[model samples]
Target: MNSTTINLPTPLELMIDLSDDQFFDLCHKNRDFQFERTASGILVIMSPTGGETSNRNIELSYQLQAWSRQNNLGKAFDSSGGFKLPNGAVREAWATPIRSPDASWIQSERWESLTQEQREKFLPLCPDFVVELRSASDCAERTGEANRLKTLQDKMKEYQENGAKLGWLIDPKTKQVEVYRSGQEVEILENPTLLSGESILPGFVLYLTVIW
Candidate 1:
């Protein structure tokens, strides 16, 4: 008797033919596959899927919303707010990327003035604050957790270098958060008290305790 093995196509391979907009829509429709655009091309990242990350993200979103409302910071979002970078035109977060962040925040000025089509096509502007939560599926390989962290770091650097006020990288595994402030060194916080700037969120204090 002879046995045969069948090969399966990866999601990225299946999506190679789609335009950027169509690709984004497809990912949104599926509600899986954390997605993002890189310097190279569009990527459909695969990660261990579960509810823990989602729950944490929801919690973070609520915190941000409360902070925003209390401080009049305009609006905050999770992975939903896509940003336009200097190099590339648009970059949106994936729905369930390997290492999904808990929440992101955008300043009021960025959201209020839209170019009509821009509001419909992409996120109004780059957010003032970004937060990423580590997951069990996060690991280091070609398409593993390590790569995800690197990609996220690069993107955060890009945003900060451009005009973003601050960014946060949360690693639940390590119980630590890496804070990125424009024109300053990346600070690792085990339990930091620093809050977001008035230029960004005014009176909002991003408590790392909530994330850890």
Candidate 2:
């Protein structure tokens, strides 16, 4: 008798630029893989998260989803949800980047305002709250964005700048969470067991043990 093992694939980064329609079509055609387009149009091809990462992600998403259900104020998203971020005021009018935070939430009003067709496509708005988990293996690498490169921390800043009311960058390896908010300095919390949603997500809190 023979048993075969399967391997999890790593993301492949490409320098090619794709138009919005082309990118959206690629995502629609390839349902099994995840894709991200930077503001400069560099495409990132991603595979599903490995076991440990997926377990951690689901816990985080579950907490947010439960809170969202009770409050009825917003929608919670798992890792597969995509968002189109608005351009920063300080930069030239560049192509908007579409990103998928590990776990995210959009206010009910904002989500409801979109037309059915708009809702069916890559969301044309940033999530009100975003969370990114930096797996132990992702510590050393940064991804390219045209000429600029970004680490997970940089992605948190991008979320804040792109109108996310709150963002958290969680690193399980160090047991630290970096908090980002509009008009506020990034707050670094070390080994914090709980995270507050503050005014932006009133009455929501996350217990971190499940993530660690």
Candidate 3:
């Protein structure tokens, strides 16, 4: 048996700028792939997750969704959801970039404020909370893992800078979690069995049994 496939053009890194509409259209044209645009209009192509990584991601998203539905406080989003940032000169006066987290949540009030079109497109606002899970690719080599850890740490900082109240970088390989929050120091939890959502989530507790 053979699987059907489309012959995509050879991937290339071009420096041409793209308007928000053009970028959105580009994303729509290639929905099968993951795309991220940086503040400088540099496009990043992300590979799809492997089976183990996808399984772990689903578990995380499911946990967040259940919690959100029960509390009725926010909306949970999976890896496919993207958010537009407010920095850069990509789109004239409305310069911005796009990013997606492995899992995220936006507060009810903030989410409700968005128009139907905004909700359907890349969210124009940052999520209230975000989570990044480390996959096998992130820890395949000692040097690479160290560099990836730094990048993840930086990403958590970026989330805080962009208005995320809380964030977590969970590394199954090291069995550790790095917590990030606005106006607080980064907290490292080693081999933690559970993670508390603090005042931001108010009664939410993330158990790490399935994650590990």
TM-scores, one per candidate: 0.73, 0.87, 0.86
lDDT of 1 at 210: 57
Please list all clashing residue pairs in model 1, or write none if there are none. Answer: 34-96, 34-97, 35-94, 101-132, 139-145, 139-146
Task: State candidate 2's TM-score.
Answer: 0.87
Off by over 4 Å in 3: 1-16, 88-95
lDDT of 3 by residue, 1-212 (tens): 99998654222234557887788888889877777776566676666767999999999999888898999998999998989975532334234768788999989999889999999899998789999998886776743668777866766777777788999999998899999998899999999999999988888888898889
Model 2 pairs in collision: none
Count of clashes in candidate 2:
0
| CA-lDDT, candidates in order | 0.61, 0.82, 0.82
Top-TM-score structure, candidate number = 2
Clashes of each: 6, 0, 0
Give the higher-TM-score candidate: 2 or 3: 2
For model 3, which pairs clash?
A: none
